[model samples]
Target: MKNNIWLDGLRSVRRMGETAVVAAKAGIKYAIEKPSNARLMRETFEDLGSTYIKLGQFIASTPSLFPREFVEEFQGCLDQTPKLPFSYIQEVLESEFAGRDLGDIFASIDEIPLASASIAQVHAATLVTGEDVVIKVQKPGVETILYTDLNVLHWSTKLLEKAVPKVKFASLADIVEEIKTRMVREVDFIEEAKNIDDFVNYLNITHNKAATAPKVYHQYSTRRILTMQRLHGVSLTDFEVVKKFTKDPSQVLITAMNTWFGSLMMCESFHADLHAGNLMLLDDGRVGFIDFGIVGQLNPEVWTASIAFMDALQKTDFPLMAENMLKMGMTDQKIDTKILAQDLERLFTGVLSADPQQILSSNPADLNDIMMDMVGVGERHGIRFPRDFALLFKQMLYFDRFMRILAPYTDIYADQRLQMIQTMDPNILLKH
Candidate 1:
């Protein structure tokens, strides 16, 4: 951890000077009539290595919080790390299992990693007794580096906020801060193990047979390392493969949706990052969820408000919607709630009536327009949603995208989706 911290500090100090130099060079190229500024910026980050690649992934994930142009561009950001030599792998394994010999534990270990990410490399291995597993080896000093890297992100976000008041409503700094905390939590493998356990227990309790996360090998894992059941199959993004795997991709989607939604009540926390890359189509034809590092938990009160908010939306009750948003994201200012409710009611009513399905569409309507209108209501009502509200909204937007990919015509609030929402014990909602 100490070494990681130092490396992170070194990276922050090093990047400042390099970014400035690159910015100057890019500016010069732009002055000479070229399209190299943004290109150079992107290239520079790529050249800066793994940490930058991870940051690029972060930007790609938070589309609602960033410029669409930059977010879209970073979707192609590459992330491949240098594979350590066999000698280094040996040393790391020995350090992990000091007195024990590898031969006694794993019957065989793959020299090649199945996937490599910014902080760790995952290699497939099998236990001596014939159990298959994958070991996730953390790149040394990753934690410390991330700490320093996040500080720099915070600083940059602060600069952006200070320079642009119009964009303050977006709160880039707060978003980065939230991400930093999540990332920091993710780098700790011990925490991840616990998260894995929670979800596993959740699956068992819910009796969800359609999906399962990998089982963790607690004895072989630690803060910097993890060993778990090796999960293999096609990624959800492979449409051709998906079609080959199942005739009813729509059915698979129902399973995924129900599993995730049920977790909000069945599990101790919810998996906040269930992106395609983190999900897999297992050999048994079940969805395999991985990476439980980032999660979300709503207060009981907020949960109640959430149900009410969605109920009102289902009925197109904008006055109730406005009231719920106000109460959920309580503010310290005064405004005419009655008038604000009436105006927002009129606005949502228009959209709800025009295309209630728009709530689940991906045709790229201008959210900026809807957001501006909501902001206008906020301005009038003195209703400033807390950062958490923004985060939750962003999550819903991700779900919207996910649904578009799987089943475009299915309405999440429709009777078809109720099988998922209704499986929960309704009594859980009355908790204090």
Candidate 2:
């Protein structure tokens, strides 16, 4: 314990020194460049790398937790980074494999990365057994850096909370804790592998043929290295490119949505980050859901409340919506259901006037505006949504955007194919 404490102390000192240097550089840049505060903060986070980049993304997605301007600016905080040298990647592979010769394992591992992100870089490789696969290699010292940065953030948030007791936003320390939990899970390839397996198993049990996830090669996978079957496809974002692959692009998206909806009621967790880049139309005509690094699991109460909210929205039941909104969110004080229902009626009467089924707008700006309005309403009612609810709501917005591009006429709420909450089987997704 003494040795561990000494080592932790050294790491903390080093981290503090590094943070000071970064802050100084950022301060100097601010003095010289005169950039907006949000932009400057985003740039500083980018320079800080890994943890800060992830934090910026967390801010971008959780609009309920941050100011609108910061959230809008941080949307440009892309997770992409300059690729680490091939030598560094090879070093990671070698160290991870330890005693085993890499040549004995991988027949050929491409030096060029398929994708490079904050946590890991992916490369196309072939197994000695003659199967094409992709290897996701964790950057060196990612876990150590992650923990160190999180520790620093945790301390800072605690200080901030004590310093300013009446902050308008949700608890900063709680947000940091959530980020720490998420980033820790993200760096763990074993957990990610299991997420993929669980999702695949869900697909099989449902006998769904239109959607699939990569097959994990367990023998080649580790906590730092994940090897999975290589998928050949174009991202669902490119409508024209998607057209070249399938005649009905809308059907493809619908299939993906159906599978995803089923997972909400069937699998252990749902793919929380279903951005266009992470979803693909595979060569085999199946929707490929990639990147299990970020997944969300909802407790039965939350899920049930969410479903109730959705059902109320679809049916235009403002009172029921108000009741479910209260159920879905956290609040200390008693709320009047009737007044809240009246407020919700006014909000939804304006929003749902055009289309009763359209719960979310297709335009990103419009969606963000609507979310801000909803957050305003929640605040007035002394309610704050759970982070998981925000995640689930954001993905639904993503699907709404995709629908506008691929299937403008289709009504997702009314579609027979969509496994709506009303149709879901009990005793699933939630562990009894």
TM-score of each: 0.72, 0.88
Candidate of highest TM-score: 2
User: lDDT by residue for model 2 over 388-426, one digit each (tens)?
Assistant: 887777677677667766777777677776664534445
Across 1-432, the per-residue lDDT of candidate 1 in tens digits comes to 697567567866776666567657667767785764335556656765566677676665554455545555665676667787555665667767878888988888898888777788888999887888998887755665566666666887777777886773376767777777777777888988988898888788656788999999898887887889988788876655887898777666667767776776666677876656677888889989887867777565665676677777777777778778766756666656678668877777765445434543322233334544555566666665543344455555445455555666767567365453444554444212
lDDT of 1 at 238: 68
Candidate 1 lDDT score at position 190: 91
Give the Cα lDDT of each candidate: 0.68, 0.82
Error of 2 at 88 (Å): 0.9
Residue 359 miss distance in model 1 (angstroms): 12
Q: In candidate 2, how many clashes are counted?
A: 0
RMSD of 1: 5.4
Give candidate 1 regions above 4 Å deviation. Answer: 1-45, 59-91, 150-179, 311-320, 330-409, 416-432
Per-residue error for 388 in candidate 1, Å, reads 4.8
